[model samples]
Target chain A: MTSNLRFVFYPGCLVLQRMPQYELATKRLLAALGIGLQDMPQASCCGAPVVESFSDEWVYLAAYNLALAERLGLDVLTVCGSCTNSLKRARLALRDPEVREDVNRRLAALGLSVEGRAEVKHLLQVLMEHRAALKESVTAPLRLKVALTYPCQVFRPGDVAAFDDPLQPQSMHELVALTGAEIVETGVEHECCGSTLYTSNQPLALSAGRRKLEASRGADVLVDSCGNCHWLLERMQRAIWAGEPHKRLPVLFMPQLLGLALGLAPDELGVNSRVVALLGRDAHD
Target chain B: MIENCTHCGLCREVCPAEKLGGRTITSLLSGGDEYSAWLCCCCQLCQEVCPEGVDIHQVMMCERRREPAPDPHRRSFENVLRYGYAFPITEDINAMRSAHGLDPVELISAEQVRLLLHCL
Candidate 1:
């Protein structure tokens, strides 16, 4: 409710390992906007696709982190969509008294409990809520066109995510609008990036991601916050178009693009390390 | 649960993994080879379009639980078991973080991860 709420920053496993740039850019951007973030004393996977698939125990794993945040008296701000989904799913599942009791029994071993006090939110949800504040901090406007993948976990199962209208998402568009960037209308804008299937079937995942990329051929950049989606659409996209003459649109996290508009250098936002070079005013305008 | 299905096949229409599997949700749910479940990407597209409001993703998740952990996914889980993250915390990663003017990341202690995994 306040302009400057502090949250337990849950940089899910993927962002820390595969995409630290998102964390750096997000932290810097949040700091610039005067939002406070506290690191979790113990940050672990939210028990998503892998653990969630294997056992119901995944809920306990997710609730454990929520309990940690509750103990710290802070809500969680997850940078990864899957982590947000897993944590939210666990929170929702905990609403059933029987399930919460069972999970709490398991957490008892770890000296934790499913108190259900901590709320899990995707970064986009947080930013969208504070777009007005964020807009005031934008020193420069990004003139480039941007297309974004809402990432299934963050948008779908809309009843749980409750961040935006999944069928007609506007949160990302609203957030991007604050930076003065054009949100291009891509046909496959809402398609699943097939990121969860990357490990199961690489070709299928790549093909699904290619469809979205091909659809975004007209946009200057593709943006998404989900690490899995970013990995497929941005990193695997290169291999998907190997040895072919194709448009190379850099896939950026929302913060990276917003960071640029906030007047942070490309290096500070880790844009220089991106697979596709982003051409802004000084770079190629 | 099959009673909830309307046989409209709208879920199949939106599902990428079902397309890859060359099967429909009805077939998979109606005693088809469980291997078809492995093809599911867990994107939840099918769940979104199901007119009957049936969670086809839950069906696929049930199958995934039975299957042996896929190698890559297993490796990622093991990474968390060891380092509280799905990726190794190497010096290069630390340098990259420092280069970005970020503090060194402090992951959940490996001890805690192991204990949690064991308890769960």
Candidate 2:
């Protein structure tokens, strides 16, 4: 059956710059689940951390991206937690007539005006919405013990992002369970992965990430849904676990793990050799 | 909105920055300028836990705008102004995309970005 679900894929700046694997896996898995992703044309940043910190123009940048998706007549599917939060917050702020008027006046120059038409949903939210389809697509059941690092911005500040329990999120756990993986309780499951802090304070960022990795020693792998979390916890593991490679836990993006269960090839999902090796060992056992 | 803060310290209880010895939301509420607002991880936990509905993130943003932004934030702002993206997109990025069997992304034109962000 051809499902009618479609979205304008918003791969925020971090994903575009640093994580092709996550993007590739997201597209492959979502397609398998009958979700169509149309690329947002001429998409820019969602006015993530930097612009948000220093200027109210962050709303303008985020509104511009939303306007592009609105023009496409589709809701947005964001892969990054920061983008999810930024866009949602901007949408909420734009509800005020004064803010909307000011933003529309500025956006008029680029031939774009946000009518608050496009809704932004993170990849996790989209996946949860299609849980029935996801269950049918899984050809492989990954029985490995998985520790989850929930993306902070995705569900927090409940009034704005308002999807899951802001304090004790369960969507990721529920989604991972569908793949037949065992979810381990890592004490730091809801802790920040320190990606936002990395640019500001490297040592503190590494310390925060290291704490999570060390606390999840019992899990066979760590899974994250946000680009920033994956970047610091997975891509920067070498720096976080310097001189102690054995202490480094394997990390996978949520889609990569889902793609594995969907029977997609590891290479196609852009899963690294370490995770592939873990899968190999799981199979042999 | 800061006026609504009851100083109940619920935000600090869940703040990663406070745990890491950085005086964040609680300090800001108490008029403490010693806090480095840049230390925030932007997790939104503080705002989520605030009983008074204080928009802590907005408060932090206001504080951040008043100070000289950290170097990384400045660079990201400059990159956004120049490329319409937070990070510079070069030919190598497209080359990598091609290798991954993904279509190359066509970024917004610099002129168009300038017009859109002229108010900045």
Candidate 3:
């Protein structure tokens, strides 16, 4: 229950761009839980999923961020699953002598080196690890029913990126339960949100998202661990599947819901102003 | 030796791209279909469901790496290389941060990030 643990925060690209709300909520909630987060002033993208395979630069980019974290002398905490996965994968890959030599040679020009000592944990892991503290901090128990969705990175390849049970992650469910919200159901919990599919096939990505949204129709809110899934499930559904008569559900990133239970206001959590407005409308209904 | 594949199509059952392609994953992968490759989504679900333990996601990555055409994500990558972020930290974003009593977003110089990328 030690809340004094400090981690270097890596928000990754998607949060900074499309979902500052998640960042805002996370910062506030973590502060409330007495966990300290330090910022990396010069970190870049986490070499997000699809982009990594597109070029060799992706691995190096991921390595650069890892080396940056290593220099700070703190374990890294990432808000985005893609960032968590990329950094973790880079850390594992750098264990190879050749890969380390190659990456270090490149980093040498920038006067940085990958020590590979820094561990990367998703914010979900950090929160769940402190579950006792989180439960004690809940001042206002959430009364709504929620369905949880984890980013694909947290549960894949089983051996390397093993953040949880790949096929059936339990940490997210446990984390949500701490807020006193009921996990209404469990089907479609591990389905891909189709964020990466957008680049190649927008319709397929939308379809994948549509499937999840349709499946979660009975829940009052859809909960997500990463910003990309938030965007894919909520934003892309609006943009690409506008004509579809899918049930509309409020999607809350992990921190936002936790912040609510911690006594933070809707505005303080930076729940998308639009979502806030929608919630207002829901209250009247 | 284990059969390469029983053609069970279990991988296809879980594949988002294969479903979208309306074709076998082997056909979509071996035929060098760029659209199908792009649609793979890197979720690695196909790899998880394959009875033969075929790493179709890795196959997709290898094909994507060898693809001669410029990446659809090139512009965003360039933005990251140039700005140290893929999207702009606009006035509205800063306003939102400050509204929550949060400090403005920070970026290391794009030149600093670009230097590391260039070194690669």
Instruction: Give the candidate number with the greatest TM-score.
Output: 2
- Write the candidate numbers in order of decreasing DockQ: 2, 1, 3
Whichever of 2 and 3 has more lDDT, that candidate is 2
Q: What ranges in model 1 sit over 4 Å off?
A: A1-5, A273-285, B1-3, B19-27, B30-35, B89-93
Q: By TM-score, rank the candidates, best first.
A: 2, 1, 3
Where model 3 places Cα greater than 4 Å from the true spot, the runs are A1-5, A240-246, A272-285, B1-8, B20-35, B49-55, B68-71, B88-96
Q: Candidate 1 on B14-109: residue-level lDDT in tens?
A: 776665554434456544453456567666667777777887767766767777777888887777667766677644666777776778766576
The backbone clash count of each candidate, in order, is 0, 0, 0
* Candidate 1, number of clashes: 0
What is candidate 2's lDDT per residue for B23-61, written digit by digit as tens? 764676755667877888889888877878888888888
Q: After superposition, how far is residue A124 of candidate 2 from its true place, in Å?
A: 0.6
TM-scores for all candidates: the values are 0.90, 0.96, 0.87
Interface RMSD of predicted model 1: 2.1
CAPRI rating of model 3? medium
What is the C-alpha DockQ of each candidate?
A: 0.60, 0.80, 0.52
Worst 10 residues of 1 chain B by lDDT: B22-31
